[model samples]
Target: MLTNINFSARQALSGVISFSTCTIMVLLALAFSTSAYATAVKQAPYEPDVAAYRTALFLANMTPVPWSQINDAWADPISNTTDSISGFYALAKRPGGSALVEQIKQALAGKDTQALYAVTTRVMATALLEELSRAHNGLEDGSAKAALLRATALYRAFEDGIRFLDRDGYRSTGLAWLDVNSAAGSSGVLGAGTLETDPEKFGAALSIISDYIATNYAPETFTARLEFNAAPENIAASGASIHLAFTLPPGGTIDDQDPFPMLVLNFEEGHGIDEADLPLVAYGDMLFDSPVIFGEVAQNLGVSCSTCHNRSDINRNFFIPGVSHQPGAADVDGGFFNPLFNDHRSDSLDTPSLRGIRLTGPYGRDGRFGSLRFFTRNVIVNEFGGAEPTPFMLDAILAYMREFDFLPNSKITTDGNLTDEASDAARRGEILFNTEYKNMNGQSCATCHDPSANFLDRRAHDIGTEPPAYKGALAQAFDTPTLLSTASSGPYFHDGSQPTLGAVVNWFDTRFSLGLSKDQLADLTEYVETVGGADEPYQAFDDVDTKFRLAFDELTTFATTLNILIPMKDAKHALIMINTVAPDLAADASTMKNLDAKPDVYRLAGLLNSVASHIKKDDWDAAQKSWNEFKTLQDAVAEGMF
Candidate 1:
């Protein structure tokens, strides 16, 4: 008896413990189910169509709906009819038709005029549909065909009615009717409205509408479109070497050089001078110290501003023309005319342009140069194997370049202030641009390119191996190009390796610099996307290749037409330097030092020396290498990285 009593106590204790454990398990499961249900409820209630309708409204430039009204309609359709229904009707009328119907009904409750009109349109359309259905017969007979025709006519009438309503500014009414019909179904019983007065509910609806508007209508907020055309053949036919010619404004002379009567003929026919064209002449004359002429002679010789810099409009294909130089081919003495060689033996080369150079700094293909003056000097001597200009000539060119300006009032701007959400995102991006928030390398935007001065450093720096082939000291040192008009200079990167600015920035972030956070990067991209284009149309080209050829011709013609009015006493110095010096020698870096003491003679002497060195070295390999290396170094120095 005593043992049994003791066992009962233990059993009771065991039972109590088991009951507690089971109760706890049940509670845990219930809690989990409730949490999951809550999450599903939160995410599942969105109506995609509703969101889209809101977006269409925004894009159509309709005024935003008031929060209070939106909430009232969402909660109780009948009572909120005045505000919500009117707003919905207005939105539907913007683009008109089915898009805004559902929203309109929810606000109007069939009582609004707009809603009634919409219902009438729907009823008429349905009647036409019913007629069509009756006309269709399984039997392929005359009656069936006749019925079909009648149905088609009725359908047309219904469509006409819809069009008439839209034109008469009753689009909101039609849309509201359609919405009511859809919700009521065949029974046509209007559902009673449920009033939801909570602010949280209203906020949710606003969020949904905002998200939809952002996704669908965001593109309409800004305006900047690009249009391109090929070069024209007739332009090339003119005596002008380069098919394309930029015009200058009246009274604008190509600096210092008295306006010549033949100047009109120098450019392509029908090409008139304009204010925009002045900068080109001003820049060219300052660099060449003579009015730059574009004519047949220049085109035939393949000489043009584009000869070294290449054309910016076209893909940066090398400007070597249709000819190629064979390894052992007769040396291209600067004086040689129409030299042709094996195409198979040619080497691919990079040919970035000088257009928009003012915006891009640390200039050059390799981004090795910092200063435009330095880069220009080096190219004249080393790359072109040409005579260097006198100090006056150099000064003129520098002055011209300094005057280079982007077309005024060309930047894109948003129509209105961005919503608070968008503004916040953009601000975040601005901060990222100004600070070092990325990971691979810690340099901020300023570390590489300074944003204050058109986002250029006017200097070159090492960007590591942008390409597998680009390695060693030669590729390592590159100039920083300006970012002013970078928005247009697509196929970004020194090698045109990246296709877009976003890619360029991303490459720098992930591969060169520390990678950026997705949000931060998005912000940066948004800012970049706002860059705009000029109002005037870009000059159309006839045949780009022909234009390219003309560029060469114009370049030669310009060179010949330039009258260097140096004193007779200094003529010999000019002649000896221009004629006697080997074109290669004039461009040679090693020989550059010998001519440096005489700055005026440096370009001519350096080019001559570079040419002489190549010829004497008898190794085209060494010659080309020297030329390329010197150019890289020159560009680097100009950009101030060196």
Candidate 2:
């Protein structure tokens, strides 16, 4: 069964009550204010002509009112009615009025506090009468009808000379900034005879507005056509082929009006090629269940794949490193150089877009995995906890990743080659990267990092400097990050300490890594700069690359693209511990009692708080003290409680 969930303003208001009483009070005050609340009504500089307003109002008001009277009043704006009740009834019969009536009815039935508050403060008394007159004939609840009528009159009497706030305020405020423009040269405001005189233009304007609301405001709706069990059979029958379907937004069509294309980006592992299958890793437990640890790991150590690759669209930009770690907390390992030690800091761990990995270089951030096979194995062992994947699964996942092809950018290309002189410089830089130039030290870029293939030396070396102390294991030296997609992947360096490629080049040039003169360094940076986008060749999966397939899938999923990156063993261990230990802790007061038994609860709390304080201040010593204290407490609990 398919169920549609609709979220309304009333629901939003209700949910906020637990966390925000001030906002709730303000809304309540706005609803009850007698004066034309300045904030409640929003009006455009231009007003709709009387006729258009009347027509729109009529349609919005669901109540039945005399059409002839509305038409007559609209036709002669000069005619004034002193009787407020009569004027309200006349306006309440319109479409907008009907919508208000429905809104009130729904609110009352649901006991929506916000809606009731809005109606009491904003709805005109006469409008309430019109609704009551219609509802009286349809309902038998006398008390409810009377209550509604009384509430309406009470509001009307207090109205004074203030104008009723316009109902469109909410919509206008919510949608003011969307980049929607009128193509038909018609202003958004409806005026007298506009709809009849230029129906097409009016329709187009409405269509655009509707589309904007549908795309941005409406909740996403999805329907499950096939169950999870259907996947394995489908893949087995398809052999090497992969199938994909995109669920489009409602009211959206694949046409010129909508230029965006739907694509299923694919990433495959090396071993999968031999077996003609796709690889799948389960990353849900890491992402949702243990986000804290997963987040910590992603922030400090540089991940593979996404280290150099990136997506063209800003929204779909670089994968894990670009999105995930960019905004995370500071580097955990204090900027150490060792490959095994944590050293980076980032915000969110974003998944990289494998849109152009085929065109890019020797893979991985360190370029240690010269061949895709070696890259695949390293990822599984080091990052994914040494899980072996089935050959078919690896093949399918790899094939899917290869689907990401880059669209050419007009700004950079001329006659198929990069037009920017810097790009040509980058080509020269590539040569200097692999070979030593005159006036430069014997050390080439490839001396420390591989440039012909993976762009890494597959070996660690001391970069001759150490960073500040921090939590987590420390590395003796830092590993070199690749420059494959140096142009797009900013905030360069192993710890992402440098903000730009130029800054990185300058640092290494002056440092002990590769001392080079100004001209040599410039040429080197130029050559490496052109290595971005999906211009590189794709690596196919082969029999010999069996081990590489799993590694490739893990790296791709972990860094450049979305697949799965879970270590099943770690997940299983965590789950087992939680189920077994948490219950036992809950059952006996021994765990909680142990704190009182030895160190005492007060002391233990102080120790834990001290650790938390150090963590807050970014003090490694204080943090270590707290960790050690907590470990002792854990041991005490194990002996006494367990």
Candidate 3:
């Protein structure tokens, strides 16, 4: 796939370690002399400057790159640095930093997408070398240890590519990184248990990594192939429709800070309910929010069913640059999430609301699926590349989904008609809705929509919403979407081509030759809006801290399923339950306002993970014992956490 450029031309070798005989001999001698000085310890935390710079650099490479947010993340004030990128450039103190930065800036200024991506990624790979060199220069300094950590994080940018392109190289480079960490040693906190640095081991390990980078990602050898396995960078924008299931709107920073996004659930009722009262539904809710259900990229990014459908409603702000053509829409079978499911098409569809899902049958925009179970399974396995759900999991999800009632409406009656509170225009439009048209048949809008049946006829219609995919292809018959909460879920039609109810009415009026006047069109739009209206279209938010506390409690409710799973000896589901709840507990705890309660929350997560380990060992008694401890700890911290 790659044509070789010169192997040794224009190679930047200043920071690289040459494997000359004398150099190798010197390194080996130092390593042996200082071997006794090296000691093992737990890994240290990454510097925020390096972390922020890494995020910003990756963001800058994504398709339809979010330049503004990348800039903000780079210059995040909380980093206590004017710009993380600049700070890192200074820290590395290596030549060509200014030139690389300028190249990225120039490419961005020119709006040259490919050039910017290439240059930005080159900077990411090269920065790893500079940090490693900086670490080697000062092994005993605390900052040197941090430099080593930064170098490890930076290598991940190209880790995948290296594995794919050269497997043996991957193993060597990976092991060398561990060696470097061991060689660097630990300074320890408060002058306790400090391990002195081993210069010999550090130099030898440093050479392996430096040579690997030089041969693959140096100035002369660097190519796009080296970045093939890089992590996905197309994160949803701050105001994008894609949101956290239980989080507040316009979710928080990636770091999880105060006033950050918090969970905001919306069931049929205007208030929250106790999940313990409906155990199966509660388990289903947990499954909906658990990203581990999906494969690779989705799981890595923490995406789940609730990402697109926030609180059972469509997430209007959800978007991924390459996968989504617009906010609130995504090509489920696109190459972004899973190439196995790519249909070789750009058919991004509008995400439908899950509210009143029980009444809406013949799932999918094309109405190709007859059973909800089959459709749900297809979405998991084929669409998002998730594992096939167990029957119990499926049943639980169905039970939870069936409980999704439409938002309450006051002006509309049970028969799907407006009451006396309706405007005169709506009443007039209601007549038109039921009136027979004679374009080619004596059918009316109500014939297909069926107002009394929650505004759906449970049928597909070839009304020419769009052309067939190819010549000789069958007419595209789209499922009739329910109008129950249509007013709140805009951008109508299968492809989201219509932006409003009025636009939809206008399209139909023109398409079917409805020969209606302007006033008549307005009336028809009004009628449809009335049928779709709800008292409150979305859930109102509580303060961030309160939302986090509610989420903490809800997570525990999700864990209650462990009681049934363990008793049934269903280790599979039990382990799934534990894995799902544990990570959230740790992460959510980190963002809690009550710093004092953080430790207990972390302990709760650790205990749950311990339970999973016990289940893996087939120790039911141990698992149960751990679960009980987890519950006890939860109760203790319940009153103290945010």
- The RMSD of every model to the true structure, in order and in angstroms, is 32.9, 26.3, 13.0
Report the C-alpha lDDT of model 1 over 1-642, residue by residue, as the tens digit: 535433223332333344333234433332222210001111111122222222222111111112333333223222111133433343343323344455445534533332332333333234334433343331233243344333343333222222321222124334433332232222224645532233333233323322322222222222111100011112112221211111111111111111100121122223544422443343353233211122211222323343322222222222221121211111121211111111221222334434445557666555556678787775454443345655654565555454344332133333212234344555566566678644636677656556555556666666763433434435445666655444554555544557677776677667644557887677777655433223331333343322223322232222221123122223333232223122212222222222233342234335434633554555445444544554454344432211
Candidate number of the best lDDT: 3
Candidate 3 residue 324 C-alpha distance from true site, Å: 1.4
How many pairs collide in each candidate, listed in order? Answer: 80, 72, 14
Q: What does candidate 2 score on TM?
A: 0.29
All models: lDDT? 0.35, 0.34, 0.66
**C-alpha TM-score for every candidate:** 0.34, 0.29, 0.65
Worst 10 residues of 3 by lDDT: 33-42
Q: Judging by TM-score against the true structure, name the best candidate.
A: 3
Whichever of 1 and 3 has more TM-score, that candidate is 3
- Give per-residue CA lDDT, model 3, range 1-642, as digits (tens): 122312211111210232334324433332222100001121233343344444554444333345665554434432333334443344244456666656656655665444544555666657778888888887755567878866876675555445433446778887988888877787679999787778999889998998877555544422322122232222111111111111101111112112222232344254566667777888888888776677644664566787776666676666654456667888897644554566656678988887778888888898888899898888888887778899988988887777777777787987886888989999999999999999727899999989899898999989999898799999899999888877877889987889999999999889989888999999999999998887777545466536557568768898988888788888888877776777777767755678898888788888988889989999999999999998788777676566
What order do you get sorting by TM-score, best first?
3, 1, 2
Ranking by lDDT: 3, 1, 2
lDDT of 2 by residue, 1-642 (tens): 113222222222223333233323433332222110011122112111222222223221211222332333233331212232332343445436655445544534554333333332233333434433333332333233343333233322222111112123224422321221121222236654331223343334334433433332221421221111111121213231111111111111111111112222332222333221223222311111111222212221222222223122112222221112332112222211112322233222222323444444355433444565445444433443223433533443344444444433332342223445435566666666677634345666667656444354545555634443565546445445444443544555544566666776787677744656788788766655554433332333345432223232232222211111112222333232222222222222222323344343334435544644554565656556654665576556533431
Error of 1 at 441 (Å): 3.4
